[model samples]
Target: MASGLFHLAVFAVDGGPWEGPVSWRKAVTFGLSFGLTLITIAWVSSFVALGDRARNVLLGVFAADCVLEVALITVQAWRRVPSHFNMETALDTTISRMLAVGGGVLIVVLVTLTVAAFRDGAPGAAPDVALSMRLAVRAGFVALCGALLSGAAMIARGVAEVQTGHQQAAYHVAGALKPAHAVTMHAILVLPALAWLLTFTRFSEARRVRVVAVVSAAYGAAAVVVIGVSAIRFATA
Candidate 1:
């Protein structure tokens, strides 16, 4: 919430210069929103799968990663420069590398959380809710992996573009993958929200579970289709 407010404050100020359609202010807004969403889902899922100590440590790491990432991106935005694939100067190069490291940490933390979920079945949720939350976290992990891989590809291509003197091409390359990445990254939130809504329905436990199962299947299929479209777009471009 603080992060989002800060981003809004920054947005209100006149940014002297920005990159492309995504200004640094807008990027920070997106980053803060994504970070908050991640934190919320992690907190909720922790109750279902992780013990206290493990939950604290994981949440701490996740929170720190989010904070650091947003800080770096926000700083770059205020400096009126590109945050990613920027190697024009030593400072820019260092910041870019740090951002990459943050991305790696995000992938590691989420993957570990997902593994923990699988290691133990859902504990705090009702039978149907447990099924939905478990599936949601697992699907969220899969989606996060897709996001990370596509982002990695984007970073690599962006770097190549810079090396080849086509700096603007960096952001454009692998752009189609953003939709797939963004869509999947929120499954943790969306599916779990759906699960929570199910709890209020008049359906019996069995019916709720069946509905969640069908919803999960459909969500996964939709995610796959998005990824497929991204792949085709990337190939054609």
Candidate 2:
């Protein structure tokens, strides 16, 4: 699923008016729409701050990016105008609508929690409160990581396509690393996330700060390890 999306981006990036039956606006919309979608996920995942204020800041960033992506998609739809007469175009419209609906769901959850934090803003009154805070933080963090990994993987495939030219890039791994490297980086999000789960599993709200801290730190480190390797290649390049 991911690899297909990556190549689709490449197809759109290099496409334009010259490509008969293809809308330049649609191509750009597709790339930016999906691109921002991935970043929204990453920004939240990487935020290590457990404080209420920190979570709010991350949520704000994600929301803003999502709005930008949606606006672009709307403009594209306006210009191209969906074909009521065509089955495929209707499918595209349906899929895009689904994406927006999903975004709305995230916003609702985000706002609910954010509002609660504002009303309940105070230092932990009990161990359970502290535990709940850490759990929310870790869950958000993992989600952000997944979003980023997907975006990077997509970008890397785009690069590979550019290097290999159309057909070759479509089928083979591109640029600095093999396809497996990209897969590994993305799949690693599960590791630290599992650690976090183990630390807080079904326990009552009364939680130990030290244990939560240890788990979150481990999760952060796991994310860093994947990022660090990707960074090394970028720096050398």
Candidate 3:
């Protein structure tokens, strides 16, 4: 999170419009988002029972990739060039491909974690807490998949535009799904945190589960609406 705040400070000093892929906004957003996401995944993973070596390896790679992604984006922002889908130079092409490949790595790690969330129950918690954690983690990972899908769409669309000689349009059109991407990305934190917080309340175990269920449904509904709107905008764009 400090990385994000530092970028926010940089953004203040740099003083530019907050739109565009190359803007300070990208640095700040990626820094904060990736930082928080790493933290959340680490926390949620504690509840699941994975082999130590495998878990450590996966998380280590995930952490490195998150840092690498944010660092590249920040570097490009400072260089004042488009960060993704830019092939004007050999360097830009390399960075763009690296980012794309990093994205694929993220998907694989998260998908593995998501499957584990469903396949194994939360260990060492009260039954209610376990149940809540289960629901929250599953829902959170699913929401995260939505974010990944939207991100993939953006990259695919942008790459197509870049390939067609419409370089500037590539940047603009690629962000058509930003709303959905942003909205769905953090459910992993929000839902699990919500479920965790409910544990301290007077609500009974079954009631807590019910509450998580209702909130999960509400979150799903919101995500659907956002995705639909983003899809429309993407189509029109």
Candidate 4:
């Protein structure tokens, strides 16, 4: 909400088609959407996790990372410079590097949560709920990891492109990975929601799990296909 409002404010003041790298409007839009989505998923996952201390710590880490990363991206937008793989100035390079490190931290935190989840049993919710939460976390972990890895790859490619004076190509190349990364990132919400919906159905617990397993498999496969297609397109383009 705050991000969207800030984006609108910048757009209003800077009126007139201002197409530039790291557009403030876009930065804030993504900041709010992705930030809120991540926070929400993390919060929900806490219930699925076992330990209170671990859950609290994970949420804290997630919240801090969200604020820090989005803030850096937004700052870059305000400065009218590209946020990703930008090394035009020492400061820009520092911010960009920090964001990349932040991404690494995020991946570490999520993977840790995933490991903890498997070690500790599911939450004390209903059978269906527990099952759903468990599957959601595991599946979400896989998809989110894919998203992070692809994002890291995009960053690496972008950096290489910038080095070779093909800055525009960097943007085009990185875009090819966006769809796969984005689709997988949303698995945290999609899978859980599907599970929740199944809870309302007349199916037995076993049936529901079976259905969820099939759906999860299909969903994961689709994400893989998208990733492969994106990679091929990027290479060919």
153-198 per-residue lDDT for model 2 (tens digits):
5344544554454533422332333222343333224433443465
Off by over 4 Å in 4: 12-20, 120-129
Candidate 1, pairs of clashing residues: none
lDDT string for model 4 (1-237, tens) is 487677877788876444545676557566776676676566556546456666777778877887888888888877778888788889998998999888888888777766665654545422333665567667877787788888888888888898999988888888888888888887777777777788799988788778778888999999989999999977775
Q: Please tell me which model should have the higher lDDT, number 1 or number 4.
A: 4
User: Among these predicted structures, which one has the highest TM-score?
Assistant: 3
Each model's C-alpha lDDT?
0.71, 0.44, 0.87, 0.76
Compute the lDDT for candidate 1: 0.71
> What's model 3's TM-score?
0.94
- Better model by TM-score, 1 or 3? 3
Off by over 4 Å in 2: 1-130, 133-139, 142-146, 149-153, 156-160, 163-207, 234-237
TM-score of each: 0.85, 0.33, 0.94, 0.86
Which residue pairs does candidate 3 place in steric collision? none
lDDT of 3 at 62: 97
**Clash pairs, model 2 backbone:** 41-144, 42-144, 45-141, 45-144, 127-207, 128-205, 128-206, 160-174
Which candidate gets the maximum lDDT versus the true structure?
3
Total backbone clashes of candidate 1, pairs 3 or more residues apart or in separate chains: 0
The stretch of ten residues in a row with the least summed lDDT in candidate 4 is: 120-129
